[model samples]
Target: MTTTLITGANKGLGRETARRLIAAGHTVYVGSRDPEKGRRTAEELGARHVLVDVTDEDSVAAAAATIAAAHDGVLDVLVNNAGIEGRTADNGIVAPADETVDTLRPLFETNVFGTLRVTHAFLPLLNRSAAPVIVNVASGLASMALITDPEAPAGFYPGIAYPASKTAVNMLTVQYAKAFPNIRVNSVEPGFTKTDLNGNSGVQTVEEGAEIIVRMALLGPDGPTGGFFDAQGPVPW
Candidate 1:
């Protein structure tokens, strides 16, 4: 059976993804920063739970160790779905350029460093699986093509820290996929979904947003890797 773990599974796209994967016959670990919330959500979905705070190294390591011990060090899939939008104030006025570094620190710590920390710690367990897969939940905001195009809707948004972190995530996905030829690693843009991340002010629903993530998470051995994709198809970096 496929054993999968999803970060930030307590709510939003992460919870939705976990629900879908469980229906697909995978043993999913609903990973959340809050143990109580994680357990509740996992129980509701009939899945398991793992307490994890992505930004915390020791927490991530412990979660990995727990999963490793229970599953005999074999994790079939990992969804790096945890991320933060930072203090964008509803995507309004851009923060002063001088404050860029300070603002970006926490965002990068969660979106970029957190993903790496989890992926790195879980590599051993993932490597042991017959069919290993890694899905980094990126965003359309991370796309240079979409964000830079004058006519694109993303042009209206003044956020920097969030998108930049996702851009870094895309790069990390590429590098990890290249390094692990035996595993399928890829990034997926879930589109503008109505979730807490955006205060439910998006164009799509959580189901719609989770569609691409679930697709990439369940890719076959022959499926594409090291690519940025959306529900429609490839997204230009």
Candidate 2:
């Protein structure tokens, strides 16, 4: 059976993606930091639960061991969906001028470094699969082409850390795809989906946001790799 793991699968887009993949006959592992929430979500979606805190190395390693033990050391797909927006409670974006190392650190910790940590820990298991796949959940704001275009709405966004971290994720996606020629590694833009990450202010639904993620996670051997895509099609880098 195809086995998959999705980080931050307790709610929002992650949870939705887990549900869809499970329905598609994948043995999905719902990765979450909270054991109770993770177990509950997994039960509701008929998936398994793996406790993981992407920002913590020990936690990520333990989670990897758990999945490997459960699935005979083989993981077909991995969805790095854990992330944070670092927006203030009032939903204020830190201006570029006000951006400091301290201000930017939190976002990078989870969105960038955390992604690397989880992917690194799971590489061995993923490598053992006949058709390994890795999906990095990215953002439209991470697109240099879109954010730099004067006519694009993303160009008007003022946040510095979240966009910068996701841009780093896109880079990671490219490098990983190049490094692992056999694995289909790619980044995806979920569009502006209504989720806690955006304070429910996004324009689309979680179902819509998870479309590209599910599509990429299900890629076959001939599918495209090292690309940034959304539900509509390819997103500019």
TM-score of 2: 0.99
Q: Taking the tens digit of each residue's C-alpha lDDT, what string does model 2 give over 1-237?
A: 999999999999999999999999999999999999999999999999999999999999999999999889999999999999998869888888989999999999999999999999999999999999999999999999999998998998988999999999999999999999899999999999999998999999999999999999999988999999999999999
Model 1 lDDT tens row, 1-237: 999999999999999999999999999999999989999999999999999999999999999999999999899999999998876565543555735677889989999999999999999999999889999999988999989988888766677888889999999999999999889999999999988877678899999999999999999999999999999999989
- What is the Cα root-mean-square deviation between model 1 and the actual structure? 1.4
lDDT of 2 at 61: 96
For model 1, name the residue pairs that clash. Answer: none
* Clashing residue pairs, backbone N/CA/C < 3 A, model 2: none
Please give the distance, in angstroms, between residue 80's alpha carbon in candidate 2 and its true position after superposition.
Answer: 0.3
